[model samples]
Target chain A: MNSTPNEQVPLADNSIIDLQEVSIFYSGKIAVDKVSFPIAKNKITSIIGPSGCGKSTLLRSLNRMNDFIPGVTVDGMVTYGGQNLHGSEVDPVEVRRCIGMVFQKPNPFPKSIYKNVAWGPGINGYKDSMDELVEQSLRQAALWEEVKDRLHESALSLSGGQQQRLCIARALAMAPDVLLMDEPCSALDPISTAHIEDLLFELKSRYTIVIVTHNMQQAARISDHTAFLETGKLIEFGVTDQIFTRPQNQRTEEYVTGRFG
Target chain B: MTTDTYQAVQASNINKRSTRWAEFLIQSGLGLCALVSIITTIAIIIILGKEGFSFFQHVSPAEFFLGTRWVPLLEPQSFGVLPLVWGTLLVTFGAAVIAIPIGLASAIYLSEYASDRVRSIVKPILELLAGIPTVVYGFFALTFITPLLKGIFPDIQVFNALSGAIVVGIMVLPMIATLSDNALSAVPQTLRQGAYALGATSYEVTTQVVVPAGLSGVMASFLLAISRAIGETMAVTLAAGATPNISLTFFESIQTMTAYIVQISLGDAPAGGIAYQTLFVVAGLLFVITLILNVLSQKILMRYQEVYD
Candidate 1:
C-alpha cells in the first residue's frame, strides 16, 4: 500500500468508503482480482474499463448485489464508515437500503410515476408526507418539470431517458448514503447521457457516487477520481485529471487513448 | 474461370433452389393444419345449430331455460335446465376454489425458488399429471376420495358434487401450475434485479413486482383452467350421480351438463327424438357459455397487460 505523490494528498481524509484488496469470484472463476481504492465523500468516482473487465462486478460488490447470484464469493474487506460491508453480521438488505443502485438499462417499475418514486420509501416504512417526498425526489432527479402534471401515469409511458431519470428518482426516495451507477447511460442517447452526466455533478454534492463506465470521456468529464481496470486487474488509481492527462501505467494510457482496450 | 469456382457457383444455385423449396413446403404444411382445425370447428357448429333448433321446437324456450327440473325420459318430462346449469356451476366453482390457491403457490415456488435440477424434475412430473386419463381419475375419485371423505364426515354421499369437484380440481391443477409458471418465469430478469436493488426482500420482489407484472398471463391460465373444469365429463359423470337437483349443498349428488349429455346418449332413445335432440341443445349451451367466458376474460387481461416490448 505504498502511497504515490497524488495518493499522499489530503483528499484521502475525505474517503467515505474504503476497499482493501477486494477480490470477487463467481463459481470459482475470478471476476475481480484484488482491487483496492478509496471512494471520496460526496464526490463522483468512476471506474472505466472495457467489456468483461470486472468493473461492474466491483461496483455491485460494494452493495452486496452479487449475493443474489448463485455461487458468488468475495475475499478481502470493503468498509463504509468503519463498518465491514461483507462481514458475517452485515445484512445485505440493509446494505442495499443504504446504497441504492441505477442499472445499465432503465428499469422503472411497471407502475405509476408517483408509485415508482414512492415504492422504496413506502416499503421501508416512510411515515411522513409521501406526496412531498415523491415530489422532492423527482425534482432532484430533474424529471418533475415534464411529468408533474401526470404523476399517476404509468412509468412505462415515459420516454427512455425520462424513465432512466425516474429510476434515479426512485433510488433517491430511499435517501441513501451512496449511489451506484452501472453504465446508467449506455442505453441512452447522447442528449440523455449529457442530462444524466449533469445530474451526477449536481447529485455528488449530496450523495457519494460511484459509477462504472466504458466511455473514457464520460469518466473524464464527470468524475473527480478515476480507477481504470483491465482484465479483472486494477491498472491505475488516481485523480481524474491526472489519470486522463498523465497515466503512469502503460495499459491505462493505451486504454484511455483508445489505442487498445 | 477455374473449374473449382465454376462448380462452387453451380452448387450454390442448387442449394438456394432446395432451400426455397423447403421453405414453401413448410409454409403449406402449416397452412393445411390450420385449415383442418377451422373446418372441423365449422362442421361442429353447424351440426349443433341444426339439432339445437329442432329441440327448441319440441320444447318451448321458456320451459327449457326456466324449468327447475331435468327429467326428459320419464312420464311428464320436465326439461327445465336450471338444475343442470346450477350443478355445472357448483362443480366448476368448487374446483376453482381448490385449484387456484394450490396451483398458484406451486407455480411461484417452482419458478422463483426451485433449483435447476429440482425444476427439471418437478416440471415433468406435473406434466405427467396432466397426461393421466380422465377415466382413471374418475375411478380414483369414486374409490379413494369418496371413501376418505366418508371417514371424515359420516353424512358424506358416495356420489356427491364435492368428490367430483375435487377430482376435477386435481385434473386442472397441472394446467394452472404449468401456465402460471411460464408467466412467472417470463417476467424479465431486469425487473427482479431492480426490486432487489431497491432493498426489497425476495418475497416482496415476487409478490409485488413479478406477480403484478405477469398478471395478464396468470389470469389467462386461470380462465383456461376454469374452462377445462366446466367441460370435464368422465370424472364428473362417475363421481357425481345423474340426478339434476338445484340444491346448494355440495354434499348432495348432482349431475353436470356433460354428465346429463352422457346419460341421455347412453339411454335407448329413438333417433331424432326430443331425448336425442337434447344432447345437441345442451352441448350448444355449454359451448356458448364457455365462449362468452373466454372472451370476457381476454378483455379483462388485455386491459392490464404491460407490454414489455
Candidate 2:
C-alpha cells in the first residue's frame, strides 16, 4: 500500500541506497513528489510506471545524473554509503563513478569496440591491463564471444542488440557498485530485450541494479523487488510476485491486470 | 459502381493530375537553378584552360611548375611559379596556425560549456567579425596590426607577410568558429550523456568524446578556411607587398598568387601578352588547389557521417 509521503519504506538490512522523502522539480514544477524507497544491494529492483510517471527522473537522481538538466532541483536526501548524494561536498562526477547508468537507447561512442569498453577505466586511472579489463567487461555483458575477433572495429558496426550490450559492457568496465538502467530495452526487439533481461539478471549477482521499465512482465520476471508508481507518487512497494499477484492498492492491481494505466 | 462514386474518382484523378503538373513544373524550375551553377563552373574551367594553354605555349610547363624564381613583368622574365605558391602557402599556414586552435577552443566552449543564453549572445558577436569587408580588414592590417608588429619586432617592414597573415587569420576566424561550433553542437546529446554516465568530467567529455565525434566537421571547417585564405586578394595585396620574394620569416614582404592576379587585373598588363596570360594560369592553379581542398573536406565529412548515422 502507498505509505505517507514523509514515512520511509521499511527496507532490508542489505539495502545499498535509501531515498528519504525525495522530491524532484524542474523549473519549479514538481515532477516527482515526496517519495521514499530503498534499493537493496546486489539485487535487481524494478520501477514500473506508465509514461511521464517520473520513473526516469527518479532513476537519474540516484547517480546525480539529473544535475546536468537546467533548473532541476532535488529536495530531501538520496544516501549512498552513509553520504547524501546531493550533499554540497559530494561531486556529481564522483557519484557517477560509483554508480553507472545505461540509457533507453544504445549510445556507444564513435570509437572502436575495445576503446569504448576501456575508456571508462582508462580515464579513471585504472592502473591495470586495459586489454584484460575490456575482455572481462565484455564477457560479463555476454558480448565478448560475438565481438572478440573484431575488438578494434568501430562500435557503430555492431547491431542494435550488440550495441546495447556494448553499452552495458562499457558501464561494467567502470566496476561500479550499482547500475541504473532507464528503459534499457525499450528500443530493442523482443529477442534483444530478452537477451538484455538475462544479462541484467546475471549482472545483479555482482552489481546492485535499479531499472525503470514500462514492461510489467519484465519487472515480474527478473526483479526481486518491484515499485509501482503513478503520477509522481509510489503506489506500492513490495516483492515482485506479491505486487503482480496480489497488489494491495487498487491502481497497482488495475495496472498489473492491464485494465488501465 | 455507383455513378456518384465514379464521378468522385474522376474528380480526384483530375485534382491529382493538376497537382502532378505543378509538381513537375516546380521540380524543373529547381533543376534549372542547379544547372545554372554547374554550367557556370564548367564555363569557368573551359575559359581558364583555354587561356592557361595559350600561356603555357610560350612558357613550358616544367619552367612554370619547377622554376623557383617568378619575375613575369620585368625584361629578364623568368617565370617559376613556386614563389607565388610558397607565398600563398606561407600566409595560409600562418592563418591556420592562428585560427585553428583558437577557433576550435571557442567552438568547444560554445557547444559544451556555454549556457543557451550565453551561446546566443556570444555566437552572433563572433560571426559579426566575418561580416566586415575584406578591404576594411586590409586597412586595419595596414594601420593597426603592422604598427603592433613594428612595436614588437621594431625592424619589421611597413608591408609584410606578417601583417597579411594576421589580417587573413582574423578574416577567416569566424568561419572556423561558426562551422566548428555547428559541427560540435550537432553531436547527439546522447553521446555526451553516455560519456558523462561513464564518469567523465566535462573537460574529458568535450575532448575525448564530443570533439572526436565532431572532428570531421572541425577538419572540414579548417580546410574551407584555408581555401578562403588562399583566394583572398585585397587584404594580402595591401598588407603583403608586391615584391614576390619567397622568405622564411614573416617580417619580409611577399606576393601571393591572389595578389599577382589582382596586380595584373588592375589595367597595367598589356592585353594578349604573356604577362596578361599569366593571370589566367595563376587563377587556374588557385582554383585547382581550392577544388582539391573542398573535395577532401566533403570526403572527410561523408566518411564521418557514415559512422555516426
Number of the top candidate by lDDT?
A: 2
CA-lDDT, candidates in order: 0.91, 0.91
lDDT of 1 by residue, B41-66 (tens): 99999999999998888899999999
Per residue, candidate 2 scores C-alpha lDDT tens digits across B1-309 of: 999999998887754333578888999999999999999999999999999999999999999999999999888998999999999988999998998888888899999999999999999998899988999999999999999999999989998999999999989988999999999999999999999999999999999999999999999999999989999999998999887888999999999999999899998789989998999999999999999999999998888687666
Model 1 chain B worst lDDT window (10 residues):
B12-21
Worst 10 residues of 2 chain B by lDDT: B12-21
TM-scores for every candidate against the unseen true structure: 0.94, 0.95
lDDT of 2 by residue, A1-261 (tens): 121111243555679999899999999999998889889898888999888999999999999989889999999999999999999999999999999999999999999999999999999999988899999999999999999999999998999999999999999999999999999999999999999988987887799999999999998888888888898999998877788887899999999999987
Candidate 1 on A134-173: residue-level lDDT in tens? 9999999999999999999999999999999999999999
Question: Residue A261 error for model 1, in Å?
Answer: 1.8
Clash pairs, model 2 backbone: none
What's the distance in Å from true for residue A141, model 1? 0.3
